[model samples]
Target: MESSVPALPSVLLKDGELKDVEAKPVIIGGMVLDIHATPSVPANPRTTTPGKVHYILGGVARNVAECMSKLGAKPYMISVVGLDMAGNLLLEHWKSAGLSLDVAAESGIPVWFEPVSVVKSKRVVSVVKHITFASPNEDELIAMANALSCGEVFSPIQKDNKKNKCSTESLFQMLRPAIWVLLEEGIKVVVVTLGSDGVLLCSNGAPGFMKGSSKGSNPHGSGNQLYRLVNSSCPPNRFFSASKFEGGSNLFAAHFPALPASVVRLTGAGDCLVGGALACICAGLNVMQSLAVGIAAAKAAVEVDTNVPTEYSLAKITDDAKSIYFATKMMFCQSML
Candidate 1:
């Protein structure tokens, strides 16, 4: 008898929905954990408030994966968990939620509390080296910025003078060179998320598109080209030349406003936004449309306590995107005035 070979898994796209996608799983690599917390307002010092304690699945990357799974996308979790009951339960929960955990591994449980916060800090200089190695989205970029500016990460400015002001703009300016360096590594898009202020989108060109000269002479060259910033919501006539490289491509930048929404808790909103945006992208939506969907998902996420969204909530986010899309267009037009 002849030996039989296993068939490779395939992903299918239909009617703007990613179906039966076993191979093309959204790989989320980060922390994963079960969070136990007591609800307390103002969080009185040294006093235990009378409130109901609850346990929930929590973690940046894990939450993102769960939200993506809820939004009908196959998400694969790449995380380390402790060899304990909590870890076992967390893994079981992920399995029940239809998330793929083949990439997850066993390790020590990373726990934290109010007084003792998680202290996973790294230098900005070192972080930039890792970030430029891959194409990270807006939320991930913002997280890095937060880590750098919050005094958690070591900074030369902080070392030189503790009183030196460290605004977000200053940090971005400092990191601009690092962002430019990413271009040499084939990174075409750089998204910066500004909470409530909105998102700043920077791109050299569409992903996978060949770099060409703006003069319309050659179709392909040494990957050096001029790039223009086009507001997704603005009229086609409006365009801004961001910058140009001598023998490379330029970077384009644009800002989009955040949609208004009611808030109950802001725990997993960013994760939801990232997950929703990625899912929309996988479903073949354009960058702007995917962003709009992400904003809508975040709006929905803030209204709920749980990080994992239900199917109904995901559908509601899709419905909310329609209105948010128009609102963004109006906001973009007003900004141009």
Candidate 2:
């Protein structure tokens, strides 16, 4: 299917009234029961360690939906769950939060795609060219790249080399071909997460295309502060160098360093990053500005035991985002190699 998941828009014209507008985020995917366990102390190989375990709701799409809600967006989610205990718990939370299972659709909103798993990743190749954004971790990016290219896109790497790889420049260089495959296929922006190292954002030179969307905190506040700190337009000067393709198309890319975080569970970091960016994007920030918020959100996820934080501090989110946004030295306009 080209699209079963609906996109997001800030204003929904309702009941044929142009004056009646609502901001609704449409989310589609699974809502899983996430079990978290942390040992209180180091244990011997043959014995069990005293630990804490908790169940949390998790799914790439679901996490993104919930994170957006925390950031103040009414996101209507679509997913399946059983009538069993886990399913009931999941449903109860949705009901309590007022996340919708049924809602009418809208037109002309940004579309974001998530590769739920490596196995299910290839299934979306047919719909790739239509999406506005795709957030894929290393493995999923490889899987989708191979599928999109109709063959292997990344050369095999040694196990040790893969583990020690952290430099954004080096990583982007190795993954350029694979990343380009997606860009040429028509996905507008690619946000690749590098655990602990930071995030790399690549666009077909249109990061500001969504600039006019009405989104964010009281328009006069931090919601629009990050983008104002650094320029998103210009022929890639000090912030980044310009790289032009053979066809003369310009690509804008940037490497945003990860924030210093007190690490905990790493499971939901990437998912929350996507969620944060989506929230800001829906609020009308450009991709560059939205990504800073995404990184800030990931930092919050790591400090907690759950996949998504119970709540996010707008003050902290904005502060951290500004730092990353201003400091991002883009490799966006050129090939690192």
Candidate 3:
């Protein structure tokens, strides 16, 4: 028997309002989780508040999937969530958004989340204590252990006490095989957004990187201001000195180097960027064009204070693309030797 998971047959959305409209083409599959936390509102000195709190569904996969749905694309999420309220909330949202949730893995683990607080006056002065993960089932654990022995599984190196340094390898292990199945099923475009490095596109094993601008502010205000000052004061053309690469893709490629912004809030930007890129692809753009769209979308995301802006506009996304379009064109023209 083949070791491949069968693709779910396409379900037509026949709801009265959307029946006639042309459906956007795209399927984003991955994990989704809730983020519950209280942000520190830094004052003149330094203090903490104990009043209101905020909670939202936020995972890299969730963020991108929701963003794509909002942009009129069909995003299908596949990952584990426990049999708890958090899981229920996630499924409810996905259903409401008109996204496909055919392959979701409902784990038998706890679903509650913990809150965190950041003292810095950057994005949201506070942070989440940690993210909640669904305990892997027996099959998942066996599969992960098996893949590890074969060198098909690897974990991110520990980078100190930073929250971002924690292991996401568990999620990746689940995603890899599912995505390979997606590839075999004619989904040629597959994107994995690595926070600071940029995005990774895989098709027919020809993977590439999209370099980030490294020029961004924190998702909030103060740090964002600081990044702007640094960029303005520095010599104009020296912003992207860190980028060195060649492009020109037959199928898969990356373009993070095109971004020269300082990363601040590193929260929903990756999702927004992926959504933007996918949207561009749905709009009939190629790899270079999609990178421009994705980067611009990330720029739009970082320029906001809240995680998901209510007024999430795409104009800045367009402007950001225009700013780097020529540079990407040049990179694509160069051979990757």
**Candidate whose lDDT is highest:** 2
RMSD of 3: 15.0
The TM-score that candidate 3 achieves is 0.45
Better of 1 and 2 by TM-score: 2
Candidate 3 lDDT by residue in tens digits, 1-337: 0010112111110110111122233233334564555545543436565545556777655666566555444544555567888778777776422223222112211111101111110111121111111111123322332332344353333243665553333333334453343234333334444454344444433322121122332231212332232223322233133224323232333333346665546566755765655544333233444555666667666766444444444445555665655443221122222
* 318: Cα error in model 2, Å: 1.1
Model 2, which residues run further than 4 Å from truth?
1-22, 38-52, 96-108, 156-166, 208-248, 332-337
Per-residue lDDT of 143 in model 2: 83
User: How far is 237's C-alpha from truth in model 3 (Å)?
Assistant: 26
Report how far off residue 49 is in candidate 3 (Å). Answer: 7.9
Per-residue lDDT of candidate 2, residues 1-337 (tens digit): 1122334442321111111133445777778898878799987798889999888898777788888778765667777888899999889887422233223222445567777667787765776745767877677778888999888757633333655764667677777777777887888778787777688788766344423333322242322443332223211123322222222266666788898999988878877887787766555455666788889999999999889998888777878887887788766455322
Model 1 stretches with alpha carbons more than 4 Å out: 1-23, 34-36, 39-48, 96-185, 205-248, 327-337
Better of 1 and 3 by TM-score: 1
lDDT of 2 at 212: 36
Best by TM-score: 2
